[model samples]
Target chain A: MPSDALPDDPLPSWHDGRTKRAILDFIARVTKQGGPDYAPPAERIAVFDNDGTLWAEKPVYFQAQFALDEIARKAKENPALARQEPYRSVLAKDLKALTADNHKGLLQTLAVTHANMTTEEFASRVQDWLKTARHPVTKRPYTEMVYQPQLELLALLGKTGFRTFIVSGGGVEFMRVFADKVYGVPPERVVGSSDVVTFRMGKDGKPELYKTAKVEFVDDGPGKPVGINRFIGRRPILAFGNSDGDLQMLQYVTGGAGPRLGLLVHHTDGAREWAYDRKSPVGKLDKALDEAGARGWTVVDMKQDWKEVFPPAP
Target chain B: MPSDALPDDPLPSWHDGRTKRAILDFIARVTKQGGPDYAPPAERIAVFDNDGTLWAEKPVYFQAQFALDEIARKAKENPALARQEPYRSVLAKDLKALTADNHKGLLQTLAVTHANMTTEEFASRVQDWLKTARHPVTKRPYTEMVYQPQLELLALLGKTGFRTFIVSGGGVEFMRVFADKVYGVPPERVVGSSDVVTFRMGKDGKPELYKTAKVEFVDDGPGKPVGINRFIGRRPILAFGNSDGDLQMLQYVTGGAGPRLGLLVHHTDGAREWAYDRKSPVGKLDKALDEAGARGWTVVDMKQDWKEVFPPAP
Candidate 1:
């Protein structure tokens, strides 16, 4: 009876709508005593896609912005990169040219800007960046760009004994620096795209793990399910995403042999947040949006469903 | 002061010895308040090497045995494999011939037997194997061969709020099924060697993940530290291992910023368990054993320090 007792509207930031009602109804059904849909505490797993689902992903991905910043800083050290194809395009801030290359340009930019340092060095650099980096449009700290409604939803899920994870297309180490503070998720619970790392002993007799230029996993679209299987080892009962990059992840979550919930956070508020769908270069939601209705997934229109965004602009 | 309280000889299966005392002392120092070595619950990360360290790994690895069993089962379906070099050697149960071609023979065997199946299929096969398979030398179920002392140690660490993880050279999925029941570690905490996995769509339009034989990581020797850093994201304060395969992990744990405990379990009890070190082809303990004394790692001599080996003849 206590489990069935509806606590106060936990999603206060979410306007009373069909989307909000769907989330509460599912959680209640899954947590109710001796219910057919009840999942055990450990099995109450919820996974979320980070970029567009939890935070703003345009005008470009925050990670791409980080890569751009790193390139500018390192350009002073590696002048040869300034003359290269991708780097030349990157340094010139040529977004159209970079986008025309089919991820070749982005991959090259990341390989140059993200590799060759020890993991500790990389983590420290990310931490330092988080302290100073601001969103280009909002002029707010990147961490402050997280959705307030999603934060409320996350807390509600956690209160109902769900173990949350961030399965993202962004860099794993980069998200780890702020996942705890921004999302209440720990580093080990964050799975994302990762480059290869080589382990070696330092000349000073200590172990050193250095990041290399090799791309190990992409963790987008179909790769999302692969990353989930590799890291979490269990199919999530609930999955939240905003774009086509999370299509397979939602499919995987909702396909399990139990009651499942899949949600798509539709960025439809142009005033509160940037609104672009289907045609956007970054965090495009076309295919998944077309597929969502057939899949029985809840699609939350940001303007209609959410009363506030971005933690009330800090 | 309550945090300093010891739980009535947590390792009762472990005999009273210097190695046992070292474990108790390290735990006490780390859990004690204001003693300089005190670690918070979040920082109390402990990593254990599976296979030879957690369970019995003799006559060959348990995973290798699984691969061999798979080879025989699939041999009837693909007789061409039976005519192949590694398959021929494997079907003949010729270890020497299998080892002669460096790792080429075994890798090819894995590639054939381990590829193209859904992860669920592989997991089901492993579960079926576990139910019926017996160790070549011990004639006991492989699960029964887990060390009682190590199990007690794991419980003790858990009681002290230390989060335990399995970093093994075996397949991550293989260890996951039994790790929860046997070691009380959940699937996500079990980090191990993982091959590439592909995501696909089922006929029902649901996502399906399949295992591939392209070995993404080896998770042995140097790979241990890399796996730890990649999965855990924090340096473990305590590390336990059994062979040279675990040497780098011990080094990584001990090389952290604070006081750490590194342990090596020496397989010296031939009467209770298989005992082969230094010159042994499998789970060799030569270089690590030689370096343990200088490295200040506690080396537990199984013959001398363990009062009981397996779980009280369950």
Candidate 2:
């Protein structure tokens, strides 16, 4: 089918190519009447991994950067934080040195910086920060760095009776604040990592939020499938991802019976977007490459498939 | 509106006169365009408290009852629980004896009985128990004791485009198992109490669930509003409850600017269902009573409201 035949919305920007055709074909077949793959609107469940899949995840994860910045800000206020390695490293702007000691320091920084605030306060703070925060590498607002193709895909799926969800490794509380505005996926449908929070009486004797230094759940990789099962209770008929972090989620979705589609957003365009796959520490996509071919999953080559990358780069 | 006007469904056989009218009236107004307070279907968001609002809570919370039974069953095999107060009380069939101690013992029992199992195992166990477990007072299966009026309310709301959510204090995992079958509300829409759970590799090398003792979040009383705000984000225009635990939730919903409705289910028929309130230890309905009258919240007097209770009492 020609790209012109498709709705003149996001699909027009998809670039007439194999990857785009594969996705459009899958959606059309499933939604068409009398088609063997046709599923009722109620059963059109589609889940997407947020970080690298929908938005760019370069320099560092947006949440991790937030934690590091928060730690530094807190350390400046309290001299006691200088005594702490991770906090001190964060304060010194030495991400490499801080992470060199391994993930323990990172975890400690996350715990200290993320905890003790009420869930509401934390969410409001995240909302405030995201409004002003800019991605270091791209020099654009972090929200603006979101992939245009994926945004179009989300809208297309929604138009086709699919209820889309963001199942990511990012903090659920963090993504929930802006998901509705950016992705049209409501907070209820966005599931991700979370920390335990307590509802308690504030100083004024009104209910207030208090965060506990406990990991509630981490929705990533294998945890993604588990989170989906626990939270959604229904197997998604369609799934999308960009990294090894989403491999298990994609596998779980495509493994299910009935017409299912799994698509991987391969960052193959070096010019349009920073493209690093197998050797990249952040979004390593090696294992997924072998598995995608074996499982007949659609691998979206960003250079060949996407006509536009990040909302016309404006 | 006459009870005779209701369809020949089994629901009318259970709702009391006042409860029936409040439900029918709400439905009528929401569906009718020229009614005194008409609302479009999308604006209709109805939240129900699971324990007392949907099923039997007397004798003890159904989840608490399951925990105690599991504790006793484990104690019989392990013999270590004989030293524990609540487990010992549970073994002795003296649930009243544990009430003096409050929630600590109950928490301990829950941790031991509910944790360390795969999510599938826990869900299956809940489903199995729901199938066979009978309410001690009613001698009817716990599932059968569910309010037929509320079930009808759920169906009626669904028919009119209102999405019904089970907002309760019971474990979210526990409710997710049977909510779709019992309430017609899918698990994704069901918001309730939750504990931290982890995903691990199962024996077959597939991802499996492991429940943790850490309490993630509680969806009760004030927590109800927090959960609704965090999950749904949209303020519900309609709210229903039977106890003081629901007061804050109702306040949050009614505080919204647009057309709002709040209904308090008053158990005033001792013959059909337990009628004690205000002074009752379980589901206390005191402060809410004063607020309901002041706020113009609809209060359903079970004795005067409905012509029937408990779906034919079969």
Q: Pick the candidate with the highest lDDT.
A: 1
lDDT of 2 by residue, B78-166 (tens): 79868776678668766567555665666667877777787668888888777777788888877777877777777867766688888
After TM-score superposition, what is the CA distance of residue B256 in candidate 1 from its true location, in Å?
Answer: 1.0
TM-score of each: 0.93, 0.77
> Can you tell me which runs of candidate 1 are displaced by over 4 Å?
A1-7, A75-91, A96-108, B1-7, B73-88, B96-105, B203-205
lDDT of 1 by residue, A128-222 (tens): 88889888888999899999999988888888889999999988878888898899998888999898888898888888898998888888999
Candidate 2 clash pair list:
A118-A209, B16-B305, B16-B306, B17-B305, B17-B306, B18-B305, B18-B306
Categorize the docking of model 1: medium
DockQ of each: 0.77, 0.29
Writing each residue's lDDT as its tens digit, candidate 1 over B95-190 gives 778767687777777776667788888888889889999988778889988999999999999988899999999889889988998999989899
Evaluated at residue B234, the lDDT of candidate 1 is 78
